[model samples]
Target: MSHECTTEDCRNHTSTYLCGRCTSDLQQWLDKVPVLVRELSVTVARLDNVRPAGGGGGGGHQPGSAAPISLDALQLQENLRSVGTDAKAYAQDSRAAGLAWLIQDWVTKAELLVSGPDEPPINHAANRERVRNIAPAMPTRELLPWLRQNARIVVTSMDIRNWARRGKLNPVGREPQPTYHPHEVINAWHDTRVP
Candidate 1:
């Protein structure tokens, strides 16, 4: 089950597309994206404060009349914009590489993440009918709200719904909206997250 590492010029063999070294490198690059965005933001802000380039010159144009923007500053602003808010949340991804990408829209001077991009991808919606068909029971509506309030951050409605669709969760509601028994959701959520 071994194959060549997907990264260019790396000869390591691994079952996954990336070898351990490349994955580590990519993880580090992702970790730096937020810092790079902050620095570029400061650079752009600093550029805005300087006098316009044509200032102090008598070239038939008014001095300090224009915004003080340089090519470097423009590039910096572009870099900042490319970081996209989704990538900013990498700050808490110590658990795994489920998300995180980009080497230069935020990167180190020496290396780039192999799959970095401005926007994070979106998953296709799970089939409602399929999920409904698989849910285990018709739990009371009262439990659904409670589960949502309790596990709002960890396992969202979509997560449970999708899990049920894939047979990971045997949700307990017949509603098209896809409700779950509190106990089932929590147990399943815990199992999926830990190990």
Candidate 2:
């Protein structure tokens, strides 16, 4: 969906609430902004607001004194501060939107894990043991490639354990933290050993 305005006139329409035409134009303007520009706009606004306004005007009322900052300058400074705050907020909002997309992707993957048919049945420990006995000897360099090709469908820890129990693949004997070849894990889903 898009709104209607074609020119900068919509910028002013911010306060009035853009009519359908200008709303579309303004949206197009926003869409074209690079993400870096959006982030930088916030940072620049923040820096300008905190800097001092007075400089270069010296005076001694009786012996020595400096003039107070002008009210107009102070007002202008406040306006700049407000703009910076708005930029920071926009940057945060944009980041949140990006994160939302990433989370959605993660959720979809998790859903597939729970709902897909390729997921192994959880109750068959004996079948898992049968698959495990066929696992090949480890410490061999060929293990990684074999597992990748044969066990490509093995998706969970239980799948690996089942393959190992059946003796089709052997996990490396690392003390306290053994790891197995990726392909050996994959071969388990075929209801056979890796050889």
Candidate 3:
């Protein structure tokens, strides 16, 4: 007897419950399960290697010291725990069991923990003043090319303009094309590119 395949998106008829095409796709998906599991194990090992930002092992203080945990490290630990929980939940789910999203989230959190904000976050005004005092301002046109050549990173003129508009990048001069401090631009590049 011929009947429609049980698999979604499959319209072929089969004597058995699943059509040949659907069975082939299911076999391919099953074959990927081992690879995904191995990748997840590697990710767990990498996360285990993630230590506190400072020279400390667990927290930001010396080993066996009584110093309180830094807020940044604490947040990192929390994020890691959340990732672990999410991974377990994904494993338990029968459908949509891909690990790519979980791995990406873990990587993003790890990056944040490694390159988090400066201690006692600086205010916008103080940051602007510090940038001005450190280096001379350069117009966007000149700065873009210089950054690409020196920093070996491609930061386009439009990126600088958009960052300035969004208040992510600060400018020194307001007339014509806005000028940005060299150090500020470098810092921005490091923040975004370093990982």
Candidate 4:
């Protein structure tokens, strides 16, 4: 069966993988096209016959000749500008194409690395969420009934003096008493009973 060539400019396939020499030459051409265009533009623009020197005159000569914008020098100026613009655009587009090829190659290599013969299983977000929801919530009030049902008893009291000294508990305004939420106290008791 015939296959498409990897080179974007020439996609004709002759039953081989881009023919090794064409692949190498294509890479070199793509690499040098931009540099060549840039240097050519600079050299063309720098020619003494192109840019006007000293006081501005028609095509760098005394007036009474063709206007500077209409002379051969002006044509060279426009050509240099066109070449530079085209080169920059070509370079950007070629880079994007190269990156896409690299990404495809990496993904294929990664797939091969995962398992030689076996196909990988598909993963779905909904099944992952279902697995996450199986755990039960541990609430303090629920434990109180269990402890009472089991005939377990424990004595506990807040050490207000030590708590206040350590800044662990804040005093009710002007009352010199530290306040504890009912749930927090129950949770602490449940910890001692359970663990």
Greater-TM-score candidate between 2 and 3: 3
lDDT of 1 at 140: 37
Q: Which stretches of candidate 2 lie over 4 Å from their true place?
A: 1-154, 192-195
- Taking the tens digit of each residue's C-alpha lDDT, what string does model 4 give over 104-145? 343333333222347667443443344335422222344334
What global local distance difference test value does model 1 have? 0.52
Model number with the top TM-score: 1
Q: After superposition, how far is residue 85 of candidate 3 from its true place, in Å?
A: 27
Q: What's the CA RMSD for each of the models?
A: 18.0, 18.8, 14.1, 23.5
TM-score of each: 0.34, 0.20, 0.31, 0.22
TM-score of 4: 0.22
Residue 188 Cα positional deviation in candidate 2, in Å, after optimal superposition = 2.5
Error of 4 at 130 (Å): 98
Q: Clash totals for all models, in order?
A: 5, 36, 0, 0
Off-target runs (Cα >4 Å) in candidate 1 are 47-66, 80-106, 109-195
User: What is the lDDT, from 0 to 100, of the residue 178 in candidate 2?
Assistant: 57
